[model samples]
Target: MPINLFKKSHSRQGAERSLYLAYYFRTPTPTNPVRYHTALVVLPSPSPIPLAAAAATCAEPQSDESESLPAPTQSSPTRARSPGRATSPLPYVTTATKFHAFNVPVNENGRGRVTWEFRVERDDPGAPNTPLRLRLVCLLFIGPLSQNVGDHKLEKILKKTNVEAKYMDEFPKYYCTNWMYEALQLLVDEKIIDPLPCSPPDFWEVGGQYADRWMAENHLQVPYDLPIPCCDRAGVALATPMGPVEEKCPDDETNGNALPN
Candidate 1:
């Protein structure tokens, strides 16, 4: 059975902020190569009131006079609503995960080098109440992996050197567990967190199809009016005259092949 490796660290003060890195991996199969994925979990300062609870509290029946008033113009500034108490603090805590995929080539000896970088940014740096604002940039290097290499050996290597690594799993449908393992080295080097064992969140169990269906069913609005594509798997397979070919995630029509700068 596979287990999730999770370690977390907390800030010394104010609203109780926390950060953790998770790692997992998928072994190679006849049709697919070895892949890894990562989750950088950040618990920012919680709001005094959860958005849903606040909305419920503010919900009121419309009056006839109010209904008769004209709708506000598009150019008019909207008024901010006052915060209300939430029955539970869980609703006030927000979680966001950024996904990345990596495909590595292993030699006959089943060894390969993995290199990658990840940049983590806080939602609001200027807010007075914001807890973590440092821009974390991690460059990773994991020498190689083979059948002979065990978790203990890997952990030792990570402690000696900090490296950064992402990708999806096949059967269990977990994101970048392998990359998360390697990224722990970064936190270790920075003295932010100590390695520990914990279960991954249920939210991490997802794929392209699940994401698309959930968002569509919820009638959620994506920022910048971007269309969300269903990525059934990590890479897209295209057929040419020669043979079938695989490529990176398909290009977004609005953004082209370039990732956001």
Candidate 2:
């Protein structure tokens, strides 16, 4: 499938660049279903003038449904609890890149299992802009379908990937786009990796500031240890009639009132 996005960064209007990325996951059988999450972060390239030039000149059609998706505000089993943003240790990609992922389940009986695929492409394939190239990183997360982080099944799946040598032996030492901090805890608990590598104090100060601002405006979260301010609770627990009864709070007994006090 193809996705389209518009590039509107004024600063890069004079430069030209384009990037194409394809990421995919495979399963042993079509019957195996898994909950998978994928992310793409565009870091600062050593030089970005060509990219800027390409973005400025590239023109493409937009999707009939061109609206951007809403950010995730809570956790879920079937989808990402957080969304990724475009930024990084270096300058971020200013042009809009059309990126999308699919979790297709193939099954004979209609009870299909899921596989992950993420693809990113430029607006103009024939443009003379610099080709967008960057690193692709991977992490193992704990989800409803992927609850067993260290399961042999997972190890087998990971080994199947043609990742670089560093990723095979040590924990990821680089950065994240949009991440759920809690997932990192799960990774640590499973002994998948040690403490996330730390950057120098000043570097973190600058990077974290830029990243946090980018994330807030974009409604995304990085899967790192940095603390995020919790949203205020509504204090109203909602339920449906067909749903289970709400558990009575101890305060309800003390107040001698019903209806959840």
Best by lDDT: 1
lDDT of each: 0.26, 0.23
How far does residue 89 in candidate 1 sit from its true spot (Å)? Answer: 12
User: Residue 186 deviation, candidate 2, in Å?
Assistant: 27
Quality of model 1 by C-alpha lDDT = 0.26
lDDT of 2: 0.23
Q: Pick the candidate with the highest TM-score.
A: 1
| Model 2 segments more than 4 A misplaced | 1-15, 18-101, 118-210, 216-261
| Per-model RMSD to reference | 17.4, 21.8
- The sequence of per-residue lDDT tens digits that candidate 2 reaches over residues 1-261 is 111221111121111221111111222233323112223222112122112212211122233343332222333123211112211111222332323332333453685443333344332211111121111111111111223432343333333332322221132221121122323333445554333332222211222332233343433321221111110011011110011011222322121111000
Span of ten consecutive residues with least summed lDDT in model 2: 231-240
The alpha-carbon deviation from the true structure for residue 194 of candidate 2, after best TM-score superposition, in angstroms, is 27
